[model samples]
Target: MNLNQLKYFLAIVKTGSFSNAADDMYISQSSMSKQIKALETELGVDLFKREHSKVYLTEIGAEFAKYAEMTIKQHNDMLLYLDEFATKKSNTIRFGSIPVVSSYGISAQIAQFTTNYKPDVNVVIDMHETNQQEVMKELFDGAIDIALIRTDYLDEVDVFDCIPYKKDIFVLVCNQNHPLSTKEAVSLNDLIKYPLSLLDTSSVIYTIVMKAFERHGIEKKTKCLTTRHKILMEILQTAPNISLLPLSLVDLTLFPHLCTVPLVEELTSDVALIKLKKRRLNKITKDFWIYWQKYFQMQ
Candidate 1:
């Protein structure tokens, strides 16, 4: 019935065990169990089925969990709103971005947004590893106001509204001394000559690249498949390998020894600003969304 009880319930569900949840919440197992028992008594339902070594949420518990999560989120948001009112500041806009968007130009845009909005508003940005599903979960949980993610990953079940912010073209990046560095445009066939180092298939850029190869019937193999951008860049620097990256992510200024060329076969991904469809935007978040739209339009 209380926020603490709800927290314990959610923790137990997430960690899948009372003891583990207790450890994560920095509480004793007995206290955690007592809280859950009290919660079950208040709700008049057995929330969990305790077995030998594991705990499973009862059917009713699973149904109650949805409401419990919403209640806790609303409670936290109310506290934040009151705190902002007391401080005489506009509401904070919590923004989330996948690594690709964060690296593209979101940081600079955020800086400009803060500068323009001044002391009236606060903007907080969290960079996430590229996982659209995780990002959508955070959005739904009210952890972030908006997310910058690739549109290709958006699914029907996400139930979020999105505005296309930018299109990032896939480019072949390599050491300046590499053979294809000076080429005006390289095809999938031309790229076969060099060993490829690619971001893992989970990345939208990788998907686009692979689909392009498949569409063109170009059979290719990668010398390296990594999830880390820095590691991929390191491989490019040390070896005569080419990697596909979004044009915006290829900062020649930072990697002066490397160069990027357009793919003869056009391949690109759309990055969008996504938010829960039913969530209302506050003044700060609204202003930020508008600013981002204008900024990208100008670009």
Candidate 2:
């Protein structure tokens, strides 16, 4: 009927006498007898036959004893499995970031944080190209433990604890053979003269570049609008058009013929680490958060 009752039944069968089994289990014979009786009543079968001073198991009792042993083993194994799962969950930290921050340095910082701070903990990093609002949503929904995101698109600051990690300058990138590449610096007016390749209007980079153009009262001459950097790079390779991008995302080594020049009008955005204000962080996440705070402070 229950685990303890089944255990008493098994003991009676193993020891071959109820009194001896009760003594081995440290319970009174009367109590042990009552439990075995209750188990038999629940199963509608007699488990033992009693002689003058000894007991012998009935045919059904021997069969049920094996199942009782198996059940207890399975129960203990499940408890052990759950214990291990809880330990692993506490030691793992899930980190998320935008592509720019992941490409710049956060990936390496995560490796260093694990090696220097909590070497025993596990760190999982996820990178996506979604905007700041979606990153905030992931933090709110407990999808990620921490996120590195841009501050430019953040409309509400009260929901999260934000720490500025790096500042990225928005620059104009062009192929080395392009006419703008010959100049040391180029103005927004100069950029309008050539056909432009721009990020999608939904992107923060597009908003910043357009605002700079609006201030100078110049219409943007866009030849192509794309969200993919590979396509933008391909466009710049064949066409004499330039596109705006964050300095962090521009790897001059990868695109050997590409050159980045500072915009005449200063445009920049802060990349920050953010987490929910009230959410409790696990030990690994908290340790990495402190490491990053101290790391940026030294810089």
Best by TM-score: 1
User: Which regions of candidate 1 are displaced past 4 Å?
Assistant: 1-90, 101-103, 118-133, 294-299
The TM-score values for the models, in the order shown, are: 0.67, 0.66
lDDT against the true structure, each candidate = 0.78, 0.75
In model 1, pairs of residues that clash are: none
Q: Please give me the total number of clashing residue pairs in predicted model 1.
A: 0
> What range of 10 consecutive residues in model 1 has the weakest lDDT sum?
82-91
lDDT of 2 at 123: 55
What is candidate 1's lDDT per residue for 81-147, written digit by digit as tens?
Answer: 6645643334567677677655766677777777767684455544455555456556755667789
